[model samples]
Target: MASQYSDGTLPSGNIGRDFYIPGLTPVGGEDEGTAFDMHARQTRFNFSSNTTLSNGKALKATIELDFMATPNGDERVSNSYSPRMRIATIEYDGWLFGQTWSTFQDVSVLPETLDFIGATDGTIFVRQAMVRYSAGGLSVALENPETTVTPFGGGGRIVADDNGVPDLVLRYTLKQDWGHISAATLIRQLAYDDGNAIDSTETAAALSVSAKVNLGRNDVRMMFNTGAGMGRYLGINAANGAVLNASGELESIDSSGGLIAYRHLWSEQWRSTLSYSWFSADNDTALTGMGVTESTRSVRVNAIYSPSKELSFGVEYAHAQRDVENGLEGDMDRLQFSAKYAF
Candidate 1:
């Protein structure tokens, strides 16, 4: 496999929280994490070509390989290898196998943002071991979830759980002279079956409608999406008590949210995006005595500029607050900026 860092492409970074520049290839392929905080990050290369086999039948193959850096900044060969075959089964009729985005995600409606956190939460399942079929712009997918987690501050035994199981999705799309429109629904099961013995079976669903509008010199696009789900987990713990940084000590919670965005291309040399999102989790009824109920809400706005097709930059401001009833601490805030170049 050959690695090409420059191709004016953005590899998918929906697997984790990492803003990606549209001009640069993803630091790694979409299969791994791109966040700087992760203990490991991967970079991949791909080489695909076609050849004629036995009976004049043309056969095609793609070789993909990824490189990873350890937390200690060490690179090892033992940790890297060629990607397995079967990411797709039959390419005909839009049938897919191995790994790919779920039908539930309507990426066309998403805005271009430099903040990794700004991408839809649905992108995380882009490629998984699964099978799917599509026809007449309608697609259905069944695949396992790609779970991820990070140790906050790297000291406590407890961690934020982004774990989920293989989910089922159904999607429909309509294409027009200007652009396209899409909608989807989904259901998933969570992996964590602990804490208060609450239900680990989670159901996630989303709805969205968007379109591209052309107005002579300027082109505009917009999207609106909302989703809801449940899982046994903790997003925020209050600073009220002498908290033991141990697992099974925190309360689990449920959450729901929505996102909206707008993009305008002023000209060939200038463009930008404005986006807003809010998320809130329900308090744990079982942990009523634990002194805290978990919930959170946040909103953000961003402006992205593309000086040229090869270079891009962005700035963003966000305000977020998390509240836990009778719990450890109150709330916090976040602000971010980013830039990238594509070869």
Candidate 2:
């Protein structure tokens, strides 16, 4: 009756199983027969550069190194460096220091899929360390507030503490010919006394727009975004583990939204993109006690094939659900396949 009845707890004993626990085992021990250890070789190397400074001013950079592969010895380094920087100061109407993307919306309607680090609601924002400006197109940003804190119930249990707030931004963009429109406003600073006197001040506002259309061969991109108490293009709070998003209220989870994507480039080696997103957590006492809930929905589909140009292949599927008024339910579904080569 034990075809594999340990550490693989899934029929509802509550999710577990990624076995292999030596070193005196005791975190839900299993594998009494022993003999299975080999799988932890991760490799990564990346370099990026873009320089054009003869007065047009532009500089971009990315460097990453991660390693771990061993047979008997040698080649065992965890990190040489992981750096990302984008230095910009160009003229034609836009320029100014560090971090990128946040013009508001219309990023080519986004979807190349293969999940190159994104695309499931796809509105991730980063590159902080602020200072930004863009003319004619209208853009403004001043940001700094990357915070973190982690520790979870152990010994005395019932310990849940998390706080996040670091923001100051204002953005505006409008580009026509059928795509691009943006709006953003934010001011955040929260965490007071008990958490160590950080004071308090919060305000959030957001509106994102996107557009692209070409019916002849099928190419369509559409987008919409909204924020109520603000902060949540990519939110985090995993039941209080806090990677970011600390009850500034994420606009009270009144997250409004929209996304529709369609891409077809059938001849350039085939292509496909189908997307969907809808989040309307219309406020429920603002996620009362931080237990979380207002409303949630997510969907994704991606397909890719690029016969040449750095090679490619892909497949993806995702599903999400969140509904709580105290009934409680959080869900996720994923399926993925990928292949790629680039230099």
Candidate 3:
């Protein structure tokens, strides 16, 4: 179970608990007070199998689940949530299928923290269905695509599921005795249709790099990503993929995000990490107006203790801030504690 006590309230998705988010952390309101909550939604389990094929090749399958997306029941009642799929995959002969982490993200670059996503603001955190092929250190795949857009004056948001093209990704990794490094690219066509005269598509591309370097018992992890129309692929969808121009045509948005973290071992069973993350969107005020989010950032520190490989406890403190194009800003401070047992 995990618990958090914050100086400010969180946005919806209490399922996410108190995990830090860039643009959504604070919306700049005076309704601030002590906010506290606890949940076990991040608890998860997995099932896997490996078998030999008729040709003597190995085939493996995995299905994992957690209740992060289950509708929270009334705490006054059952307070039980159902399971949801996190990853389900099949791999054989250098080929993989099903839903998993996006090729654009390096799972190893994720930092260790009590929050659901440690490096929340500047990580390429995405998971979706795809077909992938791997050879040596190179892998490529085409993934699911959806576009989020803001109207001409930024009244609200429009999630356009009218993409005519899938997102394409290519990644390569380098591993050595010290650590590992990875770089990837994503290409997609952002499309939208209002069934009127507003049907169009815009092509956009992005680049991401991540690495982990080991220094004896201490280590460092980092990631950087930038592109046009990055959209939901970066910083937990902190920015939109595109925006509708006055002509009702699609125009890709420009954005960048990155993170860095350092971990130190203090004793056999104790460790600590310090990290910082940020996300920025180059929104055209003429089109998006002053109400949309412009940038967000956060800093966090955590300490963890593990008496054994399967049992661990952690505590983290995080400070996050959000800014809008119109100069409105809000910041929050949060402290969290968690305990976990893994089998």
Candidate 4:
């Protein structure tokens, strides 16, 4: 996808941590205005294989990569970039092992858009190493664990990788002829230890519900999530999972996010999608400071045309806004174009 960010200088960086300049993201500078970029950094590919066993069981495996989350390259000479791992997994007999999409996320409800992640600010979007078990519609997983925290009275993020227990998730999906719905639960630990001013651990939990409902040749998608210490998994780390108090203790932040989209098939070769996403954090100003983000939202619309199943072209328009606890607000507008072909 090629993108043109306007009305603001959306400086490029790790879209996940920096949030595609969405929620809880700090303004880069005072003169944030229009800028442009045209690239294929979003390109991705994957390889899959299936093997059958003598006992009639089948093993499936896949490995995928994309040019995101890696170190950025200069655009002057070569514009070279590194490929980041997206997924590497193997499944057999209702068991999955390796790094893949988090069990807490419902990928089926995501809308098709030119941006890397259509509902980033309001969706459970995570990929991590795990061991999962599935039977029928129920699934359980033990995923990697880490926590992000903000220093007392406002400071940059501190990724406290000090957890011994993995994050646990339980999900159930109900499928019907018309569509499917999923509900998931996440239980995690938030820990930090600076050895000087901070050393604490806390437990947190969250829940997410998502659905895709069919409407003849069209469909509607939605998701809603609420919890404490799940910010990193939700809005792409728009807000830290917890904040440090005066006593150097971890306090999980309460937050919520949602996404809704509608897709309509204009014809066999034409389709369009409109989507909106939102995120909010309930933070104590005394602990987290008034400069932190309080809320964020975005709306986007796109049209895609595919002459064949393997080839497609698309364009999208998006507007995003964020509000700080101190009452400051910022908004950005963007336009993107994309083309894709697969073999």
Candidate 4 — worst ten consecutive residues by lDDT sum? 1-10
Model 2 lDDT, full chain set = 0.44
The residue-by-residue lDDT of candidate 4 on 192-230, one tens digit each, is 999786779999999999999999999999999999999
For model 1, how does the per-residue alpha-carbon lDDT over 231-309 read when each residue is reduced to its tens digit? 2111111111112123523222334444556666766866666665443445333433333334444455666677888
Identify the runs in model 3 with alpha carbons over 4 angstroms from their true place.
1-8, 11-17
Question: Which of 1 and 4 is the better model by TM-score?
Answer: 4
Candidate 3 has its poorest 10 consecutive residues by lDDT at 1-10
Number of backbone collisions per candidate: 16, 3, 0, 2
Error of 2 at 247 (Å): 22
In model 1, the runs with Cα more than 4 Å from the true position are 1-90, 119-127, 145-166, 189-254, 287-297, 325-337
**How does candidate 4 fare on TM-score?**
0.94
Clashes of 4: 2
> Clashes in candidate 1: how many?
16
TM-scores of all predicted structures: 0.56, 0.27, 0.95, 0.94
Candidate number that wins on TM-score, 2 or 4: 4
Worst 10 residues of 1 by lDDT: 233-242
Ranking by TM-score: 3, 4, 1, 2
